[model samples]
Each structure stands twice: as structure tokens, then as C-alpha cells.
Target chain A: MAGKKLSIIVFSGTVDKLMPVGILASGAAASGYEVNLFFTFWGLNAISKNGMQAQPQVDKNYEQMGPMMMKRMMDMKFPMWHQMVREAKEVGEVKVYACSTTMEFFGLKKEDLADFVDDVVGVATFLDRAEGGTTLFI
Target chain B: MSQEAKIAKTLDVKGMYCPGPVMETAKAIKQINVGEVLEVLATDPAAKPDIEAWARRTGHQILDIQQQGGVTRILVKRAK
Candidate 1:
């Protein structure tokens, strides 16, 4: 299992989609895999300091069940998705990258991103790190 | 193999799901010395298979597993 890696191109900001990102990242890290999370588009918003403070929203299609699902998750004592990703970083070689292009488009500075973000990088840099491993676009 | 292994640490990951159990198990295994046994008590149904796979991948050894009522008890020995 030497040098095993799992890379995710996070494209969605919705809670439903982000949950799996945290779960998979943590799981890979726990299993001794290097995990890379490249946040782009809406996913980049998810790692912003302001974005982290806002209430998490599910997809509009699941709006009716959103409240119920949130309550159920709370009842089960599940950690928030971001918390899981943070834990992943604490336990293994997990790197969270914010997309440079997205940051420029949104006029976000490095300080606006979450503290956990390892770097603000371009597509080529992300591709180089994500090469030769399991890369998922979510 | 008939004798019981001494438990050095016990981790109760009852309500957590999926990665929680395995992650905690990985962390707990490090708290004890190599060759020491860890007893994990979990309620998640995936605990058995997940921990087994974790052990296999991490090179740890699973000594025994048992289910009583709703709880699953797994005994794993640190092999590294």
C-alpha cells in the first residue's frame, strides 16, 4: 500500500455531495492513503471562511427532506462534513487545495479561504498531484 | 490459538459510522505497544468487515470477533 493516493475534484457545494467527500477522504487517510481534495467552482465556496460559517444547504431537489435529514444526522451525533475533513488531515497526509482560478473569479484572497486549505493552486498543479491515482469528480 | 489474548486497550465506537470506527481503530492501535491486543466494541453493522479490511491493509492481526445482542466485539493485535 505504499504511495497509495485518492484525489477528489470537488465540484458541488451542496451538503449532500460534500458529505461523501469528507467520508471518503477520512476513510482513505485512515487506510494509509494520501488524500487530495481540489475545490473548484461551487466546491471552492465550501472551503471559504465565510462559507464555513453559513448553514449548510442540501440540493433543492431534496428540499422537503432537508430538515428531516439534518435532524436525523444530528440525532445520530454525526460530525459535520468539514469536521471530518479536518480530522482526516489530522490523521494522515491529506491536502486541501483551493482552485486559483475560482478564487480569482470570486475575488477571494488567500485569507478568505479556510485555514485547512494547504494551498491555492492551478489546474495543472492539481493534475500533477492527482496523477496516477484514483481521482473522483464530485 | 486456544488461549485468549490480553486486552491492552478498549475502544467503544458504538454510534459512529463508516470511517469513524476505522479511523478511531487506527488511532487506538497506536496507543498500545506492538503485539498488544485492542478490543473494539462497535454497534455499526459495517464494523466487522471494515475493521477486518483495515487490519488486512494495515498489517494488523485480528484474533477474534463476536456478536452479542446488538454489539460487536473485535479483538485485534498490533502486528507492526
Candidate 2:
């Protein structure tokens, strides 16, 4: 049988949501699955050079807990979400894509994204890569 | 259990979480020769199912799994 595939469409920028993207991608990648991460809208912004280093923000509903959670993660020596993605790439076939439309909308160049981004692609390309796989939107 | 199934290396990933144990296992598996067993010692609650799933997907064989004092020990034989 062919190997399993996992595709994630990242649309949220909040740290709460982005954490799952990184964790899920890493989990699937570690399991020898092909992983594709399609970053769009706020998600595209999160992967940008500036955004990757920006302070992590939680959803408005969880704003009060953000600082405590960050502190707890720091105390536990937890890896940041981006670090997880990088580790996933090291262990498995993981491809990260930046949405072309989102880049144009935000005036972002290819270089504006984090170094791990494999390509700037459109929705059609994302669909093609995500076909016959388990796709998630985060 | 048998001499032929002896573990070649032991990867201790205790105190690590989800992907940490799995990622370490993937990397450690590469250091052993084909047919050699790689033993993983982890504390992550997900280690058992996660490593089993990883072995399944990677075409490796999981020879044994045991837990004691909250530590999980997994034996995986590299298939490729």
C-alpha cells in the first residue's frame, strides 16, 4: 500500500491554533507520512520572517491565559511551533507552501517568509498536493 | 528475546513529548543496520501507539513493548 499523506491548510494566526498545526504536522511526518502545509491568509502572515519571531498571541477568548501559558511552556523547555516544524522536516518528507494570493494581498515577497517555506503556490497547486490525503484546516 | 533479535542501540527519550519521542526514534533507527533492533525508552503517554503507528507506516517491525514505572520500552527492528 502507498504511504499515508497529511495536508494542512493553515488559516489561523493565533498561537492557540498554530500550535496544533505544528504538532499535527510533526506527528504525521514522524509516522512516515507525506506532509504538506499550505499557509494562507493569517497563516501566511504567521510564517513570514517577521511573524515567526513575533510574540505569540492567543485567541481573544483565551487572552487572559496567554502569558501564563507562554511562561509554563518556557518553564517546561517546550519547543516553539516553528521549531517543531523544522524538526518534522528533518525526520520526514514535509513541504511547506506559501499561498501566492495571500502574498500578493499582503505585499509579501518570497524572501519575506521563513527559510523553511518550500514554494509559493496557489490553491490549485495545494489541491493537487492534498489529493487522496487527509486534509485539515487550522 | 533471542540473540538474533538483540537490540543494537537504546534511545532514551524520557521526559520528551509527542513528536520528540517519535522524531528521535526515526533518527535512531537510521543508525542501526537493517535487521538490527533499536530500543526506545520514552515517557510520553503517546509513545506506545505513536511508535507502533510509525513502525507500521515506515515498514518496520515492532518486536516488543513493555512499560514499567511509567517508562515505555519499545523494540523496533529496522526493515529497510
Candidate 3:
């Protein structure tokens, strides 16, 4: 088996993409790979305590289902993506970093995010850590 | 079967969304030894195709996929 470090750059603000970003990072870690998730722009919103409970970002499927129905679908705990991200972190070497530039632009503080974030850094700094293995953006 | 010697992990992900069951299965498979099998019990219509794709792309193998009622039981073998 090939063991490699995986680094993911998360740029989307919506919860839909953000959830997978975290899940994959955690999954990679659980599979015995070192994993890091860099959260930038709206993607940083996913780590907030409130974000966990908030409705996930709507997608094309959700759009077809309509808001009321989609809300119901989300409420049913079908996938429970948020909880997966949380659990994945608990069991793996997943680290979440907030993009410093995004934070500054939004006039947001790291404290404003949910409980999963580890630090705030710039792209240059994140790339330095992501130099080897696989890199993904979500 | 004795819990300790069960030799397999079962993840019931019937209603889980895209990437949800797949992610969980991947995580569970990682915990077991190389030859251990992972049985992902999913009701999600997407699990069969998505997991098959993931397994194929990642070098893992799908031992079997059985659909009963609306749920599908996908047995996967971790890549060595």
C-alpha cells in the first residue's frame, strides 16, 4: 500500500462542498495518511458551532427538490455530513486551518468559527506544507 | 459471533447522501487489517455506483453488492 500525505485546499463557502472537504481530509487520515484541510473564503464557515446546525449549502439536487422538501430532507439526517466531519476529526489526523486572507476580508476572527479549526494561515504557508503527495481543492 | 473476533465491520448507511457512506466506509475499512472486509449497508441509491467508482479508481476491490428491498449491501476489499 502506498502511504502518502494529502493536503486539501477548501475554497467554497457553501456547506455542501465544505463538508466533503473535511470528510475527505479526515478519511485520508483515517486511512493512515497525514491530512490537512485549508479553509478559505466561505469554506471557513463550516467549522463554526452554529454552522454545524445550519442548513447545508443547497445543490442542484436540492434545487430540484425545492426548498421545503429539501429542508425536510436535510432534517431527516439522511447523510449527517456535518457529524461525519466531526467524527472523522476525532478518529483521524485531520487538521483544519482558516485562510488568513479570507478571515481579514470578512473581518472575522478565528474564534468566530466552529470548534474544529486549528489555525489561520496564508496560501503560501499552506502550500509549503502541501508540497508532497496529493493536493485537492473543494 | 463473538464481538472481538467478528472479523468484519458493518456500516449501515441506508439513507446517507453522496460521499457520506463512501467516506464512512473508507474510514471503517482503514481501521481493519488489509484482508478484513467492510460491509456497507446503504439505503442510498447512490452508494452502489459511487462506491464502485471509488473502489475502482482507488485500487480497492468490491467483493459483492447485493440489493435487498431499497437497501444495498456492498462488500468491499481494501487494496493491499
Candidate 4:
């Protein structure tokens, strides 16, 4: 059977939201699904070279628990969100895209993004890649 | 369990969680030849169901699934 595809629109930069993006991508890829991740807004910022190394942030509602959650994840030896995405790419067809409009709005260049980003794209390209597939806005 | 099948590889994903066991199993299946069996030993509660779903979706065959203590053992045959 031809593998189904999963399209995720990453709009949040918070670790809480990003973690699900990584986990879902890996889960779909493991089930032989092609994954398309469109990073926009804060999501695009989070994938930037500097953002990749920056301290993880949780939603304001969970701000107090963020440190404890991070510590627990670390103690459990859980892979970082980006690391999970990388592992997903290794097993199946997973493509990560950074929104060009977001980059321009932030005065960011392609070189400023993470190495795992497959390309800088526009909404049209993302829609084209995401057509006829399961789509999620995160 | 009925037929005696030879396992070509054994993947230990005991400490991994969620997609880890499934991802590892998918990668390991590629390392073996077609029709060769891949045995996955995982402790993740999701491993068995996730791997079973992966096998069904990828055209692979699940030969056996056995759980002992907290460990789950899965035997998968690569179809392609």
C-alpha cells in the first residue's frame, strides 16, 4: 500500500507544543507515512540556529512546571524534540520546511536556520506538499 | 509460534518509548534481507501495538508477540 502523508503546521515555539510535533512526526513516519512539517511564525523562530540551542520554553500557563518537566525528561533520557525529528527522517520520508515569509519578517536568512530544515518555502509550496493528506496546525 | 522461523536480527529497545521501538524496528528491518525475521525486544508499553500497526501498514508480517515480566518480544518478517 502507498504510505499516507501527515502535514503539520508548526505555529508555536514552545517546547510543549514542539514536542508533540516531533512525537507525531516520528509516529507517523514509523507507520510508513510521509511527514511534511511547515514551520511558521514562532515555530520558524524556534528552528533557527540560535533557537535550537536556546532554553526550552513552556506555555505561560505551565511556566511553573516547566523546569520540573524538563528535569524529568532529562532524567528519563528522552531524546530532544529535534533529535526525534532527525530519527524520524532516518526511518521514513520526513521533510521539514521553514516558512520564507516568516524568515523575511524576522530578517532571518536560510543560513540562520537549523541544518535539519529541508528548505525555505512559501504557503503555496506547503499547500502543494500537504494536499490530500492529514493536516494539523500546532 | 507454530512454525520454527529463524531470526536474522534482534533489536533491543528496552529503555526506549513510544516511537522509539517502532522506529528502530523499521530501520532494522531494512538491514535484513527480504523474508528474514527481525526480533525486537522492547520494554515500552507502546511497543507491541505500535510495531504491530507498523507491520500491518508496511506489508511486513508479525510472527509472534510474547511478553515476559515487563519486556515485550516481537518477531517480524520483512515482506519487501
Candidate 5:
């Protein structure tokens, strides 16, 4: 698994969708795989420094259950979604990338993103790094 | 039912979810020397299979695994 890669395109900003991105990235990293996360559209919101501190937003359909789920996770002392990705980075080769187009759309600069973000890149650059790897769009 | 190997570290990851146990195990194993044992105690129901998969992929050796009450005890030896 030396050269194995796991690439994820994060398109959703909801906590529900973001949870798996963190889990999968951590799991793959733990297994000695190279992990890449490409944040775009609403998903780019999550990497924003401010967004990282904001209250987690869930899908409208799960709005009622969101509070209960968050409570249970807190009671269990589970790490937040972004925290998991952070841990993955600490454990292995994990890179976080923000979409350049989305950055322009949201008027976000490199300084606006979380410190964990590696770079601001376009689709071509993302695809180049994601080539021949297992890519997931969330 | 037999004797267990001496453990170099004990990671108590109780109450964590799926990837937590595996991630902690990966990090914990690195802290120990090669051929040493790292014992992992987890409450997550998925810990057994998840850790097993992690060991298989990372080339670590699982010396033993036992489940009792709600906790799963996994003894993993660092292979590399």
C-alpha cells in the first residue's frame, strides 16, 4: 500500500456529509495510504477558519435529529469532523486543498482558510494529484 | 485461555467510534519498538473488524483478540 491514494472531493458542507470525509480520511491514513481532500462549493465553507468554529449545520431533513445526534456525540466525547481530519494529517500523508474557483466564488483568500489547508488549486491540479487514485465525491 | 505476551502499551479507546480506535492504534503502534506489543481496549462494536483491517493493511501482526462484556481487547505486535 506504499503508493495507494485516497482522494475525496468534498461538495457538501453539512455535518452529516462531512463526518464520513473525516472518518474515511483518517482510516485511509492510518492504513498508510496517501489521502487527499479537495474542498469545493459548499464544502469549501467548512475549511474556512470561521466556519471551523461555527456551530455545525446539518441537512434540513435531519434538523430535528441533529441536536440529538450532536448531544450523543458530545456525551461520547467523539471528535468533531474537522478534528478527525486533523488527526489524520498528524498520522500520515494527508493533504487538504481548497478549490481556487470556489475561493473566488466565496471571495475567500488563502488566509481565510483553515491552517490545515495545503494550497488553493483548480480542477486540473486536483485531478492531476488525484489521478489513478480512488476518488470519492461527497 | 493461554498466557498473554507482555504488553508495551495499553491504549484505552473506550466510547470512541469506528475510525477512532483504528487511528489511535496506528499512532500508538508507532510509539512502541518493533516486535513489541501494543494492547488496545475499545468499546466500539466495530473495533474488532476495523482494527483487524487496519493491521492487515499496514502489515502489523495481531497477536490476540478477546471480547468480554462490552470491551474488546486487541493485542497487536508491531511488525515493521
Candidate 6:
């Protein structure tokens, strides 16, 4: 066993937060920790293969806050969020589980999602793996 | 220690989050070989948890880590 095994429960719909989830998981994979990331609710965007999307904070002013902000951040060398996720798969053995309950509601399947998903599991299955470890609700 | 022995390389990865720090650490660790070590400095607030997690899954050895000035410096040894 390592120092501590950690689990993160993601419930966000935006790809931005989901991107970080991958990065965090990647970092754990790199560090040699056992990380189980549970995707529930809107967090499934992380494994969406058809195309992942994120909406920036809308600027009500007469400025191009959305595009400008995105460009500025990109110009500043913010790594493409998706690249972090892709690299995570390459560098480590990460186990990504989708919420079976949520998938049932959405009528989604492993084949329907991107190739990154490890498996589809229910809350009890996730809890079984997450026993006696740190659980993060993101 | 060889003349070219690593004194220490502190990589500050604060604003860059998640895989950013993880990927950066990977590249940095790659530059050095087995004997040499890498000192990772991060301020992402999630660095400790993330790095510790990376260590467990990757089979790499972490020499030590210390926090000062709100930055955690992780010393990692590349495993053969």
C-alpha cells in the first residue's frame, strides 16, 4: 500500500473542471498512487469523445471577454486541457469509471463514450473500491 | 557526487494545474537519469496530493518533501 489511496468524485458538467480532474489523476498516476476517479452527473464530459466542450464565463460588457480571455490564457502557455488527459493515459495506468446510474439515465454505453473510459460502475461498486481512503467531491 | 551531480532543480508549477504539473515533472524527471534526482516545487495547492498519488502508481521513489513559503518541494528519484 502507498501513503494513501485517494478517490475523486466529479459532478461538474463543464469540460474545464473535468480537464483538471484528468490532470490531477495523471499527476497521481505519475506519482505512483492508486487513484480512482468517479464520474457522476455532468462530469462525464471528460470521457466524451465525439467532442468535448466548455463555455467560458460570459462577459456582459461590450468586450470580447470570452474569446479574449481564452486567447490570452492560451497565449500564456496554458496547456490544452485535453492534452493533459491524453498524456495521463500514456504515462500511467489510470482507472476511470463512469456512473452506471447516470449512464442508465442518459442511455449511454461504454462504446458510446470516448476510448478513455475504463468501466461503468454503480455507487456501491465505487464505494467498494474507495473503502478506507480519501474521497474527494469535485 | 560527480562534478556534474545535480545540485537541485526547483520547478515552480503554481498556476499551471493538474496534468500540467504532472507532465512538467515527467519531462523534468526524464532529463535526469537513475542516480540523479529531481526536486519539484509546486504551489497548485493540490500538488502534494497529486504528487503523492503519482508516486504510488508510478513506482518511483520520493526522497523527501518540505513546504516553505507556501510551496511544496518534492524530491523524486527515478526508478529503474
What local distance difference test score does each model get?
0.92, 0.91, 0.70, 0.92, 0.93, 0.69
Distance (Å) between predicted and true CA of A109, model 1?
1.1
**What's candidate 3's DockQ score?**
0.23
| Model 5 spans > 4 angstroms off | B1-3
Query: What value does the lDDT take at residue A25 in candidate 5?
Result: 96
TM-score-best of 2 and 4: 4
Q: List the residue pairs that clash in candidate 2.
A: none
Give per-residue CA lDDT, model 3, range A1-138, as digits (tens): 344678988777565565566557655654556677888766766555555567666556556555675566568664445566666676666777888877787777878886777888888888887887789888
Q: Could you tally the backbone clashes for each prediction?
A: 0, 0, 5, 0, 0, 14
Relative to the real complex, the DockQ score for model 6 comes to 0.36
Worst 10 residues of 3 chain A by lDDT: A76-85
Q: Which of 4 and 6 is the better model by lDDT?
A: 4
For model 2, how does the per-residue alpha-carbon lDDT over A44-85 read when each residue is reduced to its tens digit? 999999998888879999999999999987876778889999
Backbone clash tally for model 6?
14
Candidate 2, CAPRI quality class derived from DockQ = medium
lDDT of 5 by residue, B26-58 (tens): 999999999999999999999999999899889
Give per-residue CA lDDT, model 1, range A25-47, as digits (tens). Answer: 99888888889999998999988
Worst 10 residues of 6 chain B by lDDT: B1-10
Report the candidate with higher DockQ, 2 versus 4: 4
- For candidate 5, what's the RMSD? 1.3
TM-score of each: 0.97, 0.95, 0.64, 0.97, 0.96, 0.65
- Give model 2's share of reference contacts: 0.55
Instruction: After the best TM-score superposition of candidate 4, give how far the Cα of residue A91 lies from its true spot, in angstroms.
Output: 1.5
The per-prediction CA RMSD against the true structure, in angstroms, equals 1.1, 1.5, 5.4, 1.0, 1.3, 5.8
| DockQ winner | 5
- Model 2, position A134, has a per-residue lDDT of 95
